[model samples]
Target: MEAATRMSGYRRHFSDADNEFEEENEAEEEYLDDPGNSSTSIDHVSSGAVINSITSKSSQSKKQSSIQQNSNQTLIKEALLRGQKLATNSREHARLTKSVTYWLAKDSQPEYAIEKPGFKRMLKAFAPRYELPGRNYFSRTAIPTLFSETYDKLKRTFSSTEVSFFSATTDLWTSCAKDPFLSYTVHYITPEWQLRSACLCTHYIVEDHTGENLKESLLEILDEWGLDAEKQVAITTDSGSNIKLACRLLRWTRLSCFGHNLDLAISKGLRDYSIEEVLQVCRQVIAKFSQSWKKTRDLAKSQAENDLPAHKLKTDCTTRWGSTYDMIARISEQQRSICVVLATD
Candidate 1:
């Protein structure tokens, strides 16, 4: 009921795509405070015969008290559950969203939950406020609780061996999602020899990607994460000048991303040769295949009839600018196909 009214109010007042978001939020609160319902709930005082009124009033009081107690308990339970979910989800969202949405519009007017920018700001509110929950909705499980939960899970997960200081790596990138300005990641090599790269932090210093900006960003990350560059024996990177500058800023010995370099070398060599011209043809061919649903089905049918191999592009979502080895791994995994594309007459 509240949501329905809120939506109606939003439709009435929501001004423009960019401008009306915050205004819609004001309507939500108004809708939730339904004026008719407030009066209806308060007006019925039950004026009747003396005995009838006394008994009816007593029964009503008892019923209301019981309802209130149950409501309070329900509120408590819901709050705690929401808080627990918030803690877990907040961390997960931070890591995931940092890649795409880095900067937030602060101090802006609030909008309805459904409004895009309003929804974004609401989520960002959870970004900095994951400390502890003391409200009636959920039990308090802030940083201490979160860390304890993590440590326990880790201890049991690696019961066979003792864990030590983890080897770490960091990287910076502008996500194609383009929502976030900058993303910084840190990798932790565990005792079991598995590599895990998690977002340490993401910053929105500004729009331009420059050498000075890269150096400052890198320094900020290390400082915020309390990492000592001297202890980080080696860092890795692709051929990006900004990334190289970042490594230099950190004073870590740079490990060239060999796998990436090789792939890039192939790409560059192809561009310098006739490969660039051929790629335009390949792109047109792909468009022919993808132009319409009918075209896609027809292409599939023709390929099946002609016994031509279905081509697939290789993807390496995990490959980082510093991951030379990862670049090589990806290239080698599909070397035959890539070679055919590159060396085609």
Candidate 2:
């Protein structure tokens, strides 16, 4: 009977557990049947999915934008490099070359100056990528072309109708190499009333500079320039016998240069004994200072001490009275300093 009672107790325990489980299941079913609870669960799931999709798309878009920006920057850099390279080949190169040619011609620099290392370095500092041509190119091509263009332009201006009449001046001089050269220059008034002047020619005279030879040379120069003898108003020249005779031979109006007359008068006046001796002493002093560096340095120190201008002593040229005047003027200006320096010596 004890064994049968135990078995019945076990069955009762199981029956109570089953009742609890059934109660839990019924509660869950009631909660699910509510419309508000069901909609809230579905909305929460849909919102989570939408937020994830938007975040993923935004990440992809940012990555694409970064890549596109990098590509655009690369294209710009490449384009800039191409533009710089193109500058060396096109109008910019030509302009730079022309400017260089003009500078060289104006300054009378040798053609090989362009090939110098220092010049190349300086130019490279200004334009790194530009290629410089050889000196031969300038000598053969650029210089000749510039000369031709300038000549043609001048010729056109001189031959224009606006230039009705012109006066000329002629001079003869021997170069340092003992070669005789005769130069002719013309002056005119433009239509705008502006004074204009141009050097027509400087001819090397192999023959003697006689009156007849000079006249022939002048005529040839005028013919070459298309200048009519009738249009010439006058020719001015120094009072040299040969040149004066040449003016008479041409049979055109001739005028003596006032500057030449003034120079002659000054030269004659300076020949007085007292003035000549003083000029000789001044010249000797200048020569001494020029020959000795120590004297020059002493002169500079004396000039500073006396609060005088630091001007060098000028040597006069015998042919030009203006140079004599300049020499005398400079000596007078530095007289105290010179005395101090000589006293110290």
Candidate 3:
């Protein structure tokens, strides 16, 4: 009987635990099903808050990133502007102007070239913010300043004791406009044994090219440079009567230009009947090719095929016999190409 009572007690305990578990589950299901429940509403509000927090953080991060990018761009733009301003300042401007003047004088280009639209465009492409000077500035101010500085420096060099005696070479030539000019170049040895040469003057001759006129002009140049007349060892000049007479009047040792004499000798020798005939035929052939663009192109093609230099045919100058020799030599060098092109014609 006691054992049966113990079993009944155990059954009662398990039946009570099962009833409690079913009651808790029914309460949880009721809470989930009810839309108006406070606990469910609180959970929905918490989830929405988490989503809003994430969205706000993301937006703020993107905004900061955009602001940082804009700041970087602004800094770069400011740095560029500062650099451009520094480059175009007065000091740099003057330096660049001097460089431009030097380039123009060295290349023998006209001052007006800087003012051309194409040249200005090129400068803009190189340095967009830097402004180039006008032609008037280069021609008047920059060029004269450069000349004065160079003249002073050269005068100082000539006055130095390192250069004691110098030999001079002078020549007179007429420009295409019929304006005559005289040029004098001086050569000297430095104390270090370096042979140096410089053109002292190229003055325009308003008067005739008489011996007296040339002598006076030369003396004036020598005096202006503070060059001692006694220190001048010799002067080399062509075989012109007036120049020789001027050198004689100066009483300085005069030397005939060897190149000019050689040219003269070669020219005299080339006057032979057989050589003249040959040169005339060569001239005719050169002229024929020069006159026709088609033949010139064909000659270039033939030269490539023959593995020869792609040099154009040279025309001899009437005054320079060396050029005549050069013309004949060039013809000889390209003989195969010339023959091939002529055959095509």
> What C-alpha lDDT do the candidate models reach, one value each?
0.54, 0.90, 0.90
* Clashing residue pairs for model 3: none
Q: What would the per-residue lDDT of candidate 1 be over residues 109-224, giving only the tens digit for each residue?
A: 22222236655576557554333222221213233344455546644533334323333444455566755455655555676788765555567756456667777777776676
Top candidate when judged by TM-score against the true structure: 2
Question: For residue 127, what is the lDDT in candidate 3?
Answer: 61
Q: Which stretches of candidate 3 lie over 4 Å from their true place?
A: 1-89
Q: Write the per-residue lDDT of candidate 3 for residues 280-308, one digit (tens) a residue.
A: 99999999899999999999999999999
Please give each candidate's TM-score.
0.41, 0.75, 0.74
Output the lDDT of residue 164, model 1.
36
Runs of candidate 1 with Cα error greater than 4 angstroms are 1-168, 187-197, 304-345
lDDT of 2 by residue, 1-345 (tens): 998999999899999899999999998788789987998878888999999999999999999999999999999997676556436558878888898999899898999899889999998777665678788999999999998898888789878897899999999998889899999999999989999998877899999889999999999999888898999999999999988888899898999999989999999899999999999999999998999999999999999999999999998997765999999999999999989888876
Please tell me which model should have the higher lDDT, number 1 or number 3.
3
TM-score of 1: 0.41
Number of clashes recorded per candidate = 16, 0, 0
